[model samples]
Target: MKFRLLLSLFIFSIQHLISQTIDKEKLLEYYESQRYADAAQYLQSMYPSDTKDTKSLTQMAYCYMMSGKLPEAEKSYLKVNSIEPENVPVLFSLATINSRRGNKAKARAYLSEIIRLDSLNFNAWKQLAGYGENADERLKYLKKANTLNNTDPDVAYDLSMTYRELKQYPQAYEVLKTAIAADPGNFTLQQAQLPVANQLGKYREVVENGEKLLKENTDANVINEMGQAYFYLKDYQRCAALFKTLEDLGVRNEGTLYFMALSYRELKEYDKAEIYAKKTIDEGISNHTSIYYTALGGIYEQKEQFSNALEAYKRGLTFSSSPTLYYRLGLLYDFNLKQAKNAVNYYNLYLKNKPDPEEKDQIEYAKARIAALTTTKELVKK
Candidate 1:
């Protein structure tokens, strides 16, 4: 029995070698002659069990992918990756397909891992560098790639992000100056260079290009960014005026309203601040409405209207499922309204949301209040 088992394994190994060594010329003929179905059928019969035949698997995956058998193709690629985790070609192919299939996060994860494994992979660096939220990390990778291969303009452009992210104004300005020299009037480089300068607190850069942006691009982003630069330079009146201009010019988005209210708050124009805060809600900007709600509640609290403040906080709770609202409401009830039951209710709600490691003690205190409220209620019923 042992001899038979060993003999069977030997035969299988030989047959697998035979399958893998099948003539490349024949396979190419089958593929080029549009015999995908026949080629697949023959390949499957020859290697009934999956094996580490990279070329054969790649061909089969391509056929499967082209035939719209995406699952089969994906499985084949997974088998390839299992066999060779560090195969740049396999990883790149898989990443490209994942990206095309709209699995951006999955694509990003794969590309990021590949870059981590092989930093000199310029394709991976270039593709991932375009991700807006991850521009900083991507730029780091790109700089490494540029150090490896200096002639690539994409590498230079990508590495320019360090200036923006690190707020290295002069270095960014100098690098961007050189990049623009290399590729004068390239739209992306031109667009990115100014922000790097702005971040570095180069107000002169803003002043120099601000007029050009306003004249050439009436884009809301351009306008908002210019307004922000002015705001940072302590030009509060101009900031408020620009925000008001944006609002008047049909740029009255939530961001515009939020900035306008902030500008007003900074300018000590509390009436205008309240007006914009209320308008932000009226415009149905629900995501950041909590901040505005807290602002309005704070205003009411300052005016000594505890009832209105509490109601505003409660309204904020409805708009946002934020724990901060409940926490503030709890504090208001506990300290100002002298309503322990309401305080307990809000505290419990806050506790439900407060799971941060630093907030464990606060969470415990809130839970105790809730438990106390339950006990008191039971005693009253009795």
Candidate 2:
């Protein structure tokens, strides 16, 4: 019996040793070729139980991370950390996982630990300066990162964001300029730069560039930005004119219709506003429900077309689940048609939804109107 046990143990030891003796080079080649699933399977099949096989274990961890097997990656990477406590790359990889999993604070702490270990880690410094931090601190970290890798597009974008947070729009523009100069075909940089220009009230810059781009190759997004810039500058006529041109050019999308409604509403052209608002609905624009309904209802109510106002409010309610629709319905029924019973029903519906706290007093006033109507009905019966 003792001899049989000894033989079994010897065979197990030999098998383990054979697996440990597998080549690291072949595994890495598979990884580099982007065959991550194959690499992971190969690494796992030959995993070494030996304490000194740190490289094999770390490779297994990286393979798991690459293949999106995060739980397995976490376990393997933890093993790598145990073997190589000073491995900055491994720690940064763990930090990235934490960030992707939405644990930003943990990710930041891990990044800070990396910075502590290697003070010149540019990527770590740049990531640590992202949004919701003090602008000065972000700038300091980003500037440090840029010093290490000035030509990095990501670093340039980070520095631009830092400057934007500081409200230093000109500096942000310059940083974007540097980034674009490095990679002129970077559509992302152009998209990011547009918002910074808008934030800085650089309307003329937006209009000029956007208009030139429109002439060369017009796009819906660029045209929307240009329209917003004109709207910001209070150039209602020009804004309408531009959107009209877009409409004529067959860019009569929901967004353009919404903008047209806004422009016409701003100009106090309620009839035009109603036309475009209806167009927005017909085009299935989801976001314009509030203003579209309110504007349309207001236009009809102003014209004393009570039935039309009621229909507009009801249509708006179908698309949106807002209590404001009920409130508007109640007001139109009470004031326009003098349908006190129907008005009371809508007012009660609005009250049930708890519309807004500021409107609480107004709702109480509406309740008084309902009570007065009830008393009038009783008197009429007498």
| Best by the lDDT measure | 2
Q: For each candidate, what TM-score against the reference?
A: 0.47, 0.56
Q: Give the Cα lDDT of each candidate.
A: 0.72, 0.77
Error of 2 at 310 (Å): 20
Best by TM-score: 2
- Model 1 scores a TM of 0.47
Instruction: Report how far off residue 284 is in candidate 2 (Å).
Output: 16
Worst 10 residues of 1 by lDDT: 7-16
- What digit string (tens of lDDT, one per residue) describes model 1 on residues 86-160? 877778778777777888887778888888898777788777765536656666666666656654566666677
Residue 277, model 1: lDDT of 89
As a whole number from 0 to 100, the lDDT of residue 282 in candidate 2 is: 80
Candidate 1 deviant stretches above 4 angstroms: 1-53, 66-68, 78-86, 97-119, 125-142, 146-178, 213-216, 227-245, 252-382
Candidate 1 displacement at residue 254 in angstroms: 9.2
